[model samples]
Target: MHPESEDDSLQRHRLHPSSLLFSFLGQAKQFFLPFLLLFFAAGDSWELWFALLIIPVLVFDTYRFLTMRYRFAPAELIVTGGVLTKNERHVPYARIQNIDLKQGPIQRLLEVAEVRIETASGAEPEAIFKVLSLSAVQRMRGRVFAERGEARPEDADEASAGRTEPAPRPELINSLGPKDLILLGLNPGRGMGVVAVLWGLAWQMGLFDGALNFESILKFFTGSEEGSVLGYSALALGFLVSLFLLSITWHFLRLFDYRLELRGDDFLSQGGLFTRHSTTIPRQRIQLISISESPLQRWMQRVSVKVETAGGTGQPAESRHWFAPLIHRHELQGILTTIDPHLQIEQASWQSLAPGYRYRMHKLSVIIALGIAAICQLIFWPWGWLSLIGLLPLFAWATQVESKYIAYARTGYGILFRNGAFWRQMSLTMNEKVQVVSQHQSPFDRGHRMASLRVDTAGAGQSGHKINVPYLPTARADELQADLVAAAGRGEFSW
Candidate 1:
């Protein structure tokens, strides 16, 4: 439904002054342990003075609780805080990118949701509305959308400009069921095994203790020598089994209560256990769509679909932002057609590497491996040679994979990068999202008429979204760079 005139429909709700007390209490709790430790570490006189100091803090908190004001206007939310500095924040409806509703265990017990509104300003500023009722949060969402003049997916357009009517709810085209959930769980793209292995390695490196506590358990299993061989073997077998089971269970539970509902132009996915999350990805916001399958997943006939959005969270250090874990590779086209009929799935002929390019790349890998081996030899002669030998085969295998798998496809709207060593990846990005494009040629590559094309996009965590086509013809790379720059200037972004 469209919003009425601001003068007629706009209303304001001020938060209860008591909220300040709760806020202060929450902040105080964060420092409670530290304060307690300090009190014990200090002498009785210092402890007594510190205890007395709490009186003024408490008095100030009480005063703030009785005077603070937080107002939610129909078109915007304003928070004016602090007794002295008077920090004021104004968040207008139009600028908000998304509203995130979060509830911790304590907040859940209190029947309150913390509303976090994310904006497009690169600073990542968020306005948090704490201890809000669920109904209130929903109402806020509706109001903000209304103020922004966003049409509901279900809305029907009128030929006559004067008349306005509410839009009917759209019909559900598809919904994920138990079978879909199971398939999603079984999807190889979830990389639970990889995650577990990484976890174990990190634990060994004393990084942090995560879901898999391998160190302590392994120590316990191998601590004694009386039945060391038998015990160690049993422990290893059990650990492997447990790891597999845990991965499966965690993957399954991740989508246990998963729900996807289509309402016009937007797709909404809601799922999670402890902290439920709902993501609304509008079709227009999607910059790229990729369907990828690792060797194992390809054998199992499964592929993962990844949709890259403009403002959503980026992938973790070594992970992907996938829409769904495991759909059969053959079914990806059908799924995309169902989601957006206009989306094109094209297979273009990929340019192959020149003979010299392949030879140079392989030589680089071999030299790097030998260099590492030489360094190792200086440190530990016999074992270092073995280490160098071990490194040789891995480098050789990597070189082979790089030669076989490195390819790219350019379509009318976007480019796709296909690469893999053992784990395959297909990354797609539209021409307009290419914020920067450049071509570079190494001396060796120049002799072969080959150059590397680099494409950069927004918000890819540390290094951002950079894709390099290693061995494309210099002319082709230059042409692509020009096209991407032109498209970006024209603002013709597409998914």
Candidate 2:
């Protein structure tokens, strides 16, 4: 037989030697706090015991590095490793949904990356090659796509020859400029979440111990015991300004130079300021698409697009599920059509909820308002009663306005559901992607002869969006569920 070529040799090789360093760092990062605690608990001569403890860790790492091996077959990837208990896994290329790569400063310098291969079977990645050479990663990507018959021209070269030419520019589907990123920051204003994290960290570090308190902050904002409204108003304004500034900064750092591209059968998103990040979503694997607009986003005539597939949930920022982080409102249909020609949201005939839906909402709102007002009165007395008056009228007006916009539609290919008052979200699920069709009625719904319909697909819960239509006439809900079930049955589900 002829000598095995370099590419063939790579097919059965172990991970690069750098894997040992990364594996050790990963272990240290995970157990640093625990080990530190133990170090202190062990007293002054803790160094000896600490060093002894680490010997076992070093031995385990060495054993793991020596034993672990992977092979690329024509149809599947075979990974085998473990010392005490040998383990092997065969991951078929067709079942793979995502192959995400991460490169921090050091990894980039070393021309290596941490690769996570995901499939629809579970929440976590199916295979994680902690560290691999850049060339190896390229070959892996090429082989995966090639085996699935979705490989681009360059993918074939990288897979077979372990070399690639300069890539042709991909089709730009959508991109976020500075203005769009700013708007995204303003609308989502996600930076407020950082305040809690910072506060926790500060508390843990003893920075807040006897240094700051809620009472002091209240006094600073309100001034004298009388609690001046102007002072509190100023404090509120300052707080909001801080949140907005933080949000803008956070967005810039995480999503700087964001762009979404369509190359062959894949959707690629790339962004980040310090460490570049990218995510790839295969076109055919998309199970659900959602368009959402917050009150601020709507006012600005902007919306965000997100998609879900069978794989990946609670992923890191680099592997997020956003299809288009932000896009102009008018571009919604155009973008949808570009993603898939079959999507026609504007053409679908929408149907509002059943009659008395508003009445039901108003009744529930009154009960909630009364309960809140009673609890407040017990705590704050006179002024608390005023809340009920305000809440009742507010709820009445909200229910009236929101009931008009809450609706669902049976599109030719899938189901579309839209709801929300201040923050509206519309979601579409193709019939072929639907995994389950469910109908239910609560006591209140039964009283009004109403029911709810929910269509679930893979990654449904992970998307933070669902096709659940409420307050439909029981008959309509039943009819919709049956129709959806029939349609789903007709089309074979793809990953």
Candidate 3:
């Protein structure tokens, strides 16, 4: 490799020309909305001064784009931007999590991607350079990650001597079948969307709503009042058919060609149809891994996976999960084994929550029910009673079932916490990533001789970013807290 090229790798860099479009795109809402208002307000006057207002934004974008600069220094990456005020941010290699790139259709056309730098900080992304060439992003990623291909020849022999067979290029961890993708798309954004739609239809059909005179509609469909039975049956059949078709269509669009693979030491997910997305997640940087499933998925024996890295709580939907897009419950363990072999993900084997745990959840559920019912009562008396009476049993039942599965487990490197009933969420957090472990005991918990442990990590939510294992035997909770604190201390502190 040429010395000049190696030096150029660390040299100051500028974003691609398309960055101007990116600035406009980022502030498009601000610019276009005002422009739209002007157009609506000043109809004819808009044409006269359209360029006057628009040209300034374009000129500012160009100016800011030209001034923006980034450089990879020996110890850190520095990004400088802004027009009037010079904004500078220095991110050290140790603090950096993943240097990611995202591409849309326009970005793909220009062969450029939005480069985002996520560090240990779980707030805003440290730096983002819009519309940089994919090659440049990869180069920056490589440099930040391992300083790949930039080592001196004197060190090359030393590094090469220890390495073997190029470490076998990353292979597919799991591949989605036709049925898998279909079932995945079935859940789409909401697991019960189709059911809700069908329920709405049934309500409109006078099955739930008495206002809709189905008998009249039956007379129109058939001939006499006797045809009401046939009409209801036919309508029910039509609803089922419509539900089936809608589920298939929704599933098709969301999870087409979904595949999760392990590339080198990174997790790569490639999926989507209209708007394609390929996300690369660094294995070591992952702070939390969650496996979730709905009632439909459970019946189909499938589960979805989500991995949260050190930084950026608000990630795009497509880039959410590492595996959970329609993986079978049986196959989930095996797929996860590739990433964490020592960790046990078996649902049946997890340590169940304390037996008295349900009562606490039940109490909480009742309070919530009362709160809702009271609010509804203010609107209408009958509706309030209906809300209370209707939801009380349902909430109690949900709490009962959810409390049954509330469990926690531990491995040498990681800790697991499971909760929820219909929408089960199982979180696996690395010991190293645990920032703090807090134990809380309410007056209720004290009476029951139980305590709750809340484990905090960087990738978890800012406020509620805690894995709460409630209703633990006080003695057991104390023992567990010691173990957790020791485990966290033993590992190198990672965010």
The candidate that achieves the highest TM-score relative to the unseen native structure: 2
Per-residue lDDT tens digits of candidate 2, residues 48-111?
4664676688789889889888876656788899989999999998898888777776787888
lDDT (Cα, tens digit) per residue for candidate 3, span 326-436 = 676887778677776665666435787667777778899999999978866775656666777788999988988887787888667667888886778888877788888
User: Which window of 10 residues has the lowest lDDT sum in candidate 1?
Assistant: 153-162
TM-score of each: 0.74, 0.87, 0.77
In angstroms, the error of model 2 at 222 is 9.0
lDDT of 1: 0.61
Clashes of each: 0, 0, 3
Q: Among all windows of ten consecutive residues in candidate 2, which has the lowest summed lDDT?
A: 1-10
lDDT at residue 295 of model 3 (Cα atoms): 80
C-alpha lDDT score of every prediction, in listed order: 0.61, 0.78, 0.70
Error of 2 at 117 (Å): 0.8
Q: What would the per-residue lDDT of candidate 1 be over residues 198-303, giving only the tens digit for each residue?
A: 7555654667666655556766777763555677567657866676566556655555566555544555555555665555555445555656676667778877
Please give the distance, in angstroms, between residue 405's alpha carbon in candidate 1 and its true position after superposition.
2.7
Candidate 3 deviant stretches above 4 angstroms: 1-6, 10-12, 21-30, 46-51, 69-71, 80-89, 148-168, 188-255, 313-322, 347-349, 362-380, 383-396, 462-466
Local error of candidate 3 at residue 263 (angstroms): 2.4
